[model samples]
Target: MSQPTSRPTTATRVYLARLKGTAVFDPLGDQVGRVHDVVVVMRLKGAPRAVGLVVEVTGKRRVFVPLTRVTSIDAGAVITTGRLNIRRFEQRPTETLVVGELLDRQVTFRDDSGTATVKDVAMEQQRNRDWHVTKLFVRRAARGGLMGRRGEGLVVDIEDVTGLAVNPAHQGATALLATLEDLKPADLADVLHDLPDTRRLEVAAGLPDDRLADVLEELGEDDRVSIVSGLDVERAADVLEAMEPDDAADLVSELPDAKAAELLERMEPEDAKDVRRLLAYEHLTAGGLMTTEPVILPPEATIATALAHARRQDVTPALAAMLFIVRPPLETPTGRLLGVIHLQRALREPPHELIGAILDKDVEHLLPDDDIGKVTRLLATYNLTALPVVDEDRRLLGAVSVDDVLDNLLPDDWRGADEEITDQAMTRTAHG
Candidate 1:
């Protein structure tokens, strides 16, 4: 992590209905729970400000996850920081539940137009990191319910609609930020990069930490540097912590030593510790390129748990292709590196079997100083998607995946080159 300027990014506008029951993932992308509702604090003047989400985790217990702790929110999943307050959620007098209380309520157009039932509400984040209710989706009552089409639905700005509470009001509309809800990080980064700096930073300020980190990674280095410099040091650190350790380490290396040191200290100990270790290694070395984050289990774990961990979508396919087995501590620098259970074999074994029983002990591990060439040859020879890196004592440091190797192998400007190739192909497609 390094002190940054600003995180230039696209604003994420999430509709309330789509978020309900969506999987809530942790910093590592493992599903922690499902979103049950969004909590907001109603205001006197502007749209209600969002506070956080009510997520239902283990034991059917609902807990509060604040917007500041949220890393990304999309239809597929809402990712948050690993830290959470597990205490049961209790609604206060000032708090509003968007999913529980607002949907289907009748609202009036502030201008005294007509009324429509609230179908959905959109919350948008701003440059200051605060979330505000920005839009509402409403439908006019169906004139022909059984025989004909239902009422028309339109996206409307929040100011045009009245009533956070259930009240009889008309729903006339105005278009807001409905189009930005579905953009991929790369596509969204392009859009943000083209915007004026002020607007770009404003949107970036509002994005979830992990999402902003992704968009920043897609931008050119100059733009990336400018944006990071714009963010406050604390927030800059948060974004970096949300990023993959290797990416974070690379970005941190680009900063002034003093700033980098300060920002790393500001990061969570677990996250900062990994990046610090990465910083000690050569950028192209196996230890530097490999992510410290990967599925690790102790010897006592079973195939059922291992398989479930492997099936998670958050971990990249390469990382998921093998599970590292260690001694006592499950975290990286994990106890003596025993072996890896390849996903292909794990799939065929009975779920009840112990993972230690099937562990493939023959795989040779790489030392931290191992060159990229060695990593490539080992992976190629074994036909492995990833290979473990270890200390002299055979303690697991991390695992290097195929993509990490290729990313470093490619030219530094490969992303720009890729775009050029794509544009040329599109031009040919048009003429052909």
Candidate 2:
């Protein structure tokens, strides 16, 4: 058959649902077959680009047809570049078939709302002149659905779909991770740890640096080591850089000396310095547990400024609960600690009031060499979530949060009980 004589002048957008089972024709106006599925190349961080279509040809055998050969899609018919190969379709590792793998899948939206069934996917032409799945059509059960009525339907941008709950029959880690894109790093880490080694590594390969760093922090030491070492040297260094200095140092400390040094050399000079500083302290001491990234501001800053800083998305709830006031040369390993202001005080104080005025000077602090026992005792005595650590000259080095202290004080298997603890907490909250 020759190429189709008529073709659409401009690219058109169409839903995947409408395209499936559509009749496909060659250039000579001959009926070839029907589209069995759309094939897309799954990417680690962006929309999956359309590679081609799977068409059910003679003898009901399916074959791959590259999108480059497609001329147009209109009125339930697809026009092709006129040539067709007669080989049976078999999906490669990098490819996902929309009809077979993605259709009818359950997905969680960006807002963490209840799951919705995927009804269709909106495809658009990209800058590269290739078609890509850019949005999703979802259906949610509504009030009327209880009586056999149709439910609400929505068209959402692809980015808004945070997670996919893959059918167990699909059984690909990449597909599972694609749907789990919306999970918190900690939650994702928990899931990753439970996966088999090869699958875990495959999923880890797709996570961005910041997300990987957060997951690494939540993972057990052995799992962290495994994931980090599995990544290429440059990527490993980037992931470490994205992590808190203390956490990065802890992970690096567990690695072989030669490998650790190589990764350190590959890291940014400033980030590597922070990690090296934490590595200088014994793991059981105050310095070892402290995070060098605590929220610290000069004494002259106002309560409003302090509050704004606390509200930043990057600041964890525990770290945002207090602000560290420091004197001149306000940098990491900052000059003498002036005072601290708890969030509670910041809220009640006038907006323009300087933090120095309401500083909590009687705060209990830690020396770098203080043992974990002493750190725990001080935190308990003061009822504080965090305690700053300083050197002999009173230069603020870092602050250890209660969670970190607990992690150290608890038995080695404490992490294994985390899910049970979380479940119990949820149960208690439900009852009350």
Stretches of candidate 2 off by over 4 Å are: 1-173, 418-432
Model 1 per-residue lDDT at 223:
65
Instruction: Write down the TM-score of every candidate.
Output: 0.63, 0.60
Error at 319, model 1, angstroms: 0.5
Best by lDDT: 2
lDDT of 1 by residue, 90-131 (tens): 774445799889988888778655677887878888765568
Q: What do the candidate models score in CA lDDT, each in turn?
A: 0.76, 0.77
lDDT of 2 by residue, 207-235 (tens): 65556888998888888899989998877
Q: How far is candidate 1 from the true structure (C-alpha RMSD, Å)?
A: 12.3
- Candidate 2: the clashing residue pairs are 3-27, 4-27, 69-81, 163-179, 164-179
Runs of candidate 1 exceeding 4 Å displacement: 1-180, 190-199, 418-432
| Residue range with the least summed lDDT across 10 consecutive positions in model 2 | 1-10
